[model samples]
Target: MPALPRARLLVAATAAAVGLGLATPAHAAPETIVREEARTAEVVAEAMALAEQLAERQQTLAVLNRRADARDRALIGYRAVLSRYGYDGDPDTARAVLPLASYDLSAGFGLTGPLWEAEHGGQDFSAYAGEPLVAVADGVVTEVADAGPYGLRTILTLSDGTEVWYCHQTDATVVVGQEVAIADVIGSVGSTGNSTGPHLHLEVRPAAGDPVDPMDWMRAQGLDP
Candidate 1:
């Protein structure tokens, strides 16, 4: 190569220096680097705070769900108890119900049995001793006393002036004037009067008069024995 002119050589050297300056990156100042780091830290802190809030909300929702489940279980248990007594939610639409949950028809009314002096005046329901006895219909307790052969008895007068007698009970739970709804537990079954095993002697009387067939009366009230 031939030697270049001085002015041209100087101009070429200046152009090369300018190109090197454009290609290489400049070093950042210490204060600028620190500011960039602080900005990054701020962004990270905001993300962490949002994550914590979401976790707390999730925990709160879980607790609420647990409480709702517990309440549902309690309601189911309460409904089960009511169903056992034949209460179908609305009491006004319900007619009559069975006096006991489980029982078998034994000696019926007008049947001649050796356990009775004359013909049987009431229907007999064979059941276990100490079984809960419920009211057959809505009525007010008119009498609670012990008779000669009827044992511990309770007389409930219905709304239509019909009287129902619950005999052979272990004890009476109502007073003389307490109102009772259908399926209300009035007493328990027992052999209190005449000689017999655990049973209930149910009697029906119109206007508190002569005894009648309890099975037929219950059927009239839209219930089977």
Candidate 2:
């Protein structure tokens, strides 16, 4: 039994000088003493908060692409085809302004329209039962069908000679020549043709055989429509 003590001989010569690899008191504390200008100012404030959240998501996608390009230029119409009313004399009078059709009738009218009140002689909610139909101007379709109570129809044809009937429709997408643009849906909202409930029996000729008087052309387009 020998003696050792002196703090266990200075703790075994500081663990044999940290097993000969030398540096010890927990490697004397120096991991680059946390500097480099405070880690480059916290990496430039996290790259300026990720460039201000990518400039507020590029200004909310440029205001939702300018409101979907102003509702696709209000369903394809601005000017061209100004109210004719011809019965096929073929004069080529040039005019095609579109965007008229759009009635809520507070929410009445659908199928072939005119519900009681002496057949819409009172003009209640006037139009719409299922409402999707949209192709006011750049058209071509020509005519699609449905039968069974006119449950669907199309008949586009616009280039100035007008004629854009699109009644009832529960689904028609488009067919004939198939050009379509303004409101482009071309079919939806249905009570099907001769309906009693759902609605959208639009009709407007103004030329190539006139029918003119869709609520005085939807109040000449300023639209209470």
Candidate 3:
């Protein structure tokens, strides 16, 4: 009977050991699953951040493309205007040229200042005294005389009957009714009449009417100045 009790104790100890072994593996499985989930979440977060950065870059590129398209359209429109004015022979000479080889823009049209009784009607090209001035387009000399406030001036009439005034000139090279082409030396800069400094005061009058902004007219002719 004592041997039977000892065998019963041995069997009970073996069974208890097996149960502890199974419980250990079950507890460890939950910890392993939590570590895997954390790694997956980290990978997903990194991917989301990279995707947001890519979207922002694409938006910036889209804005740049829009601005490029706008500039291209403006260039095309100005080129068309030049072609309509019969300047389409050579691409190099297709646009109207500047009157002076080197000069600075000093004043603008429609400005309110003490120097004028009314709003200023012309654009001023500031340069040294006796700087050579040239014709801006193909035209005939309409007037070349001394005016009270304009000093000595030269006027050229365009094919469209538009008059371009070259004011504050020391002297004029072209006479009345003489045809002049673009860039022909027409006068020299001065500070005569109601003047301040040596500058060419340029004016544009469409159809011999009131003066308009010469800068705007020059831009419409595909010329920047």
Say what the RMSD of model 2 is: 29.6
Stretches off by above 4 angstroms in model 1 are 1-90
Q: Which tens-of-lDDT digit does each residue in 29-87 have in candidate 2?
A: 46543453355445445544554453344334434543554575567443311221111
lDDT of 3 by residue, 74-189 (tens): 77764443443334456456536677756889989999899987899899989866666777888999998876588778899988999999897766668999999776667667
lDDT of 1 by residue, 1-225 (tens): 011123432333344444444222347677766775565455445544554453344334434543553465477763443455544555557777777767888988998867889989989999865667778888999988876578778899999998999887665668889999877777767666563577899999998899999989877866656
Which numbered prediction scores highest in lDDT against the true structure?
1
- 2 or 3, greater by TM-score: 3
Count of clashes in candidate 1:
0
Cα deviation of 71, candidate 1, in Å = 16
Q: What's model 2's lDDT at 209?
A: 78
Highest TM-score against the true fold, candidate: 1
- The TM-score measured for candidate 3 stands at 0.59
In model 2, which range of ten residues has the least summed lDDT?
80-89
After superposing candidate 2 on the true structure, give the runs of residues whose Cα lies further than 4 Å from its correct spot: 1-135, 147-152, 155-165, 168-175, 178-192, 196-224
